[model samples]
Target: MSDNDVRQFTVGPDDDGIRLDRWFKRHLPDASFNVVSRWARTGQLRVDGARVQPGDRLAAGQTLRVPPPESAVVAAPKPKAERVPLSPDQIELAQEMVIHRDAQAIVLNKPPGLATQGGTKTHDHVDGLLDALQFDGESRPKLVHRLDKDTSGALLIARTSRAAAFFAKSFSGRTAKKVYWALVVGVPDITDGMVDLPLAKQPGTGGEKMHVDEEEGQPARSRYRVIERAGNRAAWVELQPFTGRTHQLRVHMAAIGHPIVGDGKYGGQAAFLTGGVSRKMHLHARRIQIDHPDGGKIDVTADLPPHFAESIKLMGFDLSLGNAMIEDGPPPVTRADLKAKAKAHAKSVRKERRGERRSRGSRD
Candidate 1:
């Protein structure tokens, strides 16, 4: 603990909505809030390479640079931390990521590069962290929706079985407002537009990609508006997906001749233009608005990741512009039309959940 060791921490889903001082307490338990305040004043702590106050809120995936107390190596691998199936480090990691929590739900500012659900090769993921996320022992939290592994932002978790069912219905009913932010490779000619292209899984991509396949594809629509532009080079865009299709935003943008910055899978090496902008994907789940189970609404926002923020700064983009946020557009359609779709979708989701539960019960 003598030599200076710099440690960088990336904000995670659960860590969203947390104050900088509280963040230090959770992660750097040794650092007192008073010391953190001093550090912030002296510019010792930074989020996304920008100095911030200890009272500032943190979003998922933002880089937090700090020198661990006592010159300790904060990033040093915890000794045998992952020895057990679920280690203390794992549980701590899960506990530290809570952005918002209540009796019925939990909202996380999921950091980029973390998988929401586990896969064959993926082990340590949000899904795997459910054990620690079970703040209440009676009911295990449930995922309301999913975000791409490389995409960071506000993700919801249901705290109870009733809440989980309600959330499922809200999402399937299309009553939720999901917004995303991304940096595209080139500036689009049109500022505001909607892509009504049908999308389907492209063959030979390991079933992990979606393509604009009008012939045999499901309805996928997205409305995008250019927030800020750096001439004809790159621009910051706000995207709203109308249909919940896999890779809908990426494919829709790419199909329109403007691939998202750092999206190598779709845009290739051209995704990056060299220099300071990191090649990491620049897509983020900026915000989501949905009705709460206990009435009212739950609105959450997540800040850009360090890489995305760097890219934005590099492009001289100002997120405080008038067009930075696109709050309300025309309603999808008449209430009657939406009601029919909601009814059908909710019924299907409930049936599916019931089937899964019954199957599990039989197995047990």
Candidate 2:
């Protein structure tokens, strides 16, 4: 089609419920996001004779009307960074981690010591190797959530933009259920308990460390049930976080005086154990269950990593007993619930600050 001609296209079955902007990226790469937004603002972009925004979801049979391309109206496309090609071994490693794969999502049993995404000093990560996992998808799979570098378990990757958006909503809405298995240094006095503590990034720690702060901390909650105990020395526990916070499980366990085994960052030297227990972090994302974009639920469980499995065996605990204690939990906290809690926390902080100022004035 000529640049002077207005374009009309029908959405396909494959793109039945994808965002308008995503359709363009998949089918019309020349039409940049800026170009689409400008057309929408000018009332020239339409779907079924109705002016539509970039985020509007399109149906399979819907008609899309696009204005004629303008040379000046479209911004110059930015240069994309060159992706380093993965080595043959890297591709094999990525493929080996896949525990579940479907049309919408891929679940990988990420092993310990592998970073989810690359960073300043880190070049090798699951994100860098996603190109090998593209399979039949038009675009590279997107990461829906993250795990710590040393933590191993079920990591979900969205195969398409629509799936990515859906999975992201499930997480942000707190509808996704994640179960974790960790071996803590000591057994908790209370076998099953909730750690309802507000956490804040510790001062002078470069935002890398979190500590409990009743005064000005964000709300973080975790529930743990002791599955089995090896005397008072250590225990295997099942963990579920109601709110997602950085290093939440590790911090919450440590704060409760039962730091996760081998988590030296938060647990210090006490995190380790005697009698030939491996010093590697024993946290593993045991299972993940969430709603799928296509229809039913996507519930995947990851096998224990080598080190964690070894630790469990050394502790003389039966692996099958871990899932026997599964019990129904209260409905996951919604986004609105979190907002209300945060607002209350902010109000409390303000009241305390005001009280301190009034006390100083009275002293003066």
Candidate 3:
């Protein structure tokens, strides 16, 4: 009956077709697949108020109620008051202030090139400096959501265990709306459309970079509207991602033939730095809307970073145009089309190889 009692989740359109266990793994990384599988088998995981198997394919708009055996708990830690000095790189990208803060959450105007959390390759990260950021008491802040290392925008931090769980649930359910502004190469034929594509992690080859496999990938959806177009070469766009796959927006845009301006990985030669545009990855998390735990809705807007704002200006986009210019249009190509095309291509190639074998046998 309390806030920590049981969590109910409604999958969104973007979450369709993914395995229940895989979905849970992405959302709750700490929880193992076997743990989720066991819970699903024991009636702990219910779909639309009914028990479902772990391998069950989750569809959009399906309500899942998960009753944890124990109430949410937070482990209190000793306080350490220390201000760490920022590196020269960190100081250079430090353009804005910590916007909103409460006992539960903190909103920061995160600058570009700063990883939200550290990994093997990363040394300095936003998570490492949480103690320095003025917060209440001894509770340390944890990242509720992350922005890519190259992307700049509003980043959310949860102060307590409950807040983190709540926000994570909201994001997974698609109740949390995220708006990103990106400068993309090439103007889309339609002003506005939804890109419903799937993305799968492509294993890295040798020491080369990795890629997303649209053929056998996770369902990822992004709704994008071209705000302003400078001929056919470039346009400023507003991207709204319904699903938060790794590089969802970037991959979706690239699939639609208009990669994010400075993305070298997916954009290939069309991505900026290859004569398309002279700028860093011109993407910015502009705003986010979510239902606050206390009550009411919290709509936080992060002012465009200098680079994003300047890029828009250079492209001759009027920021005041609003969504008025976004006309209704057909949705962007879906993953179904990509899969069908790949299948047909494979069939044709196989047929050609068979013909070659016949001709070689006749000559022999």
Candidate 2 residue lDDT tens string, 1-364: 3545878899876677778998888887678888888888888889999999998888878999987665325555679999989999999999999999999999999999999999899988999999999998898999989999999999999998778877877887778889999999888999999998999999999998999999999888889999999998999999998888899999999999999999999999999998889999999999899999999999898999988898889879999987723344556578999999999999999999999999999999
Off-target runs (Cα >4 Å) in candidate 1 are: 1-85, 322-364
> Residue by residue across 1-364, what tens digits does model 3's lDDT show?
4547778888865355556876776565444666677778777788987888887867778988766535223234336666577665554443244777777777888878888888888977788777655445356676778998899888887776556666777877767888888888889998878888777776754423334566877767778888878888888888888777888888888888998988887887778734434568888888877777677876778887777777777767888864422222334467998999999999999999999999999999
For candidate 1, the 10 contiguous residues with the lowest summed lDDT are 72-81
Question: What is candidate 1's TM-score against the reference?
Answer: 0.66
lDDT of 1 by residue, 1-364 (tens): 2225767889876566567887787678667667788778887778998999988878768999886665433354345544236689988877767778888888888888899998888976898888788876476787879999999888999886557656776787778888999989888889998889999898998888888888999878899998888888888889998779998998899899898888988887778777678878888888888898789888878777788788788878777862335355445567899999999999999999999999999999
Q: Which is superior by lDDT, 1 or 3?
A: 1
Q: For candidate 2, give the lDDT.
A: 0.89
User: In candidate 3, which residue pairs get closer than 3 Å at backbone N, Cα or C atoms, i.e. clash?
Assistant: 199-218, 200-217
Please list the C-alpha lDDT of all candidates, in the order they appear: 0.81, 0.89, 0.74
Preferred candidate (TM-score higher): 1 or 3: 1
TM-score rank order: 2, 1, 3
Better of 1 and 2 by lDDT: 2
The lDDT-based order of candidates, best leading, equals 2, 1, 3
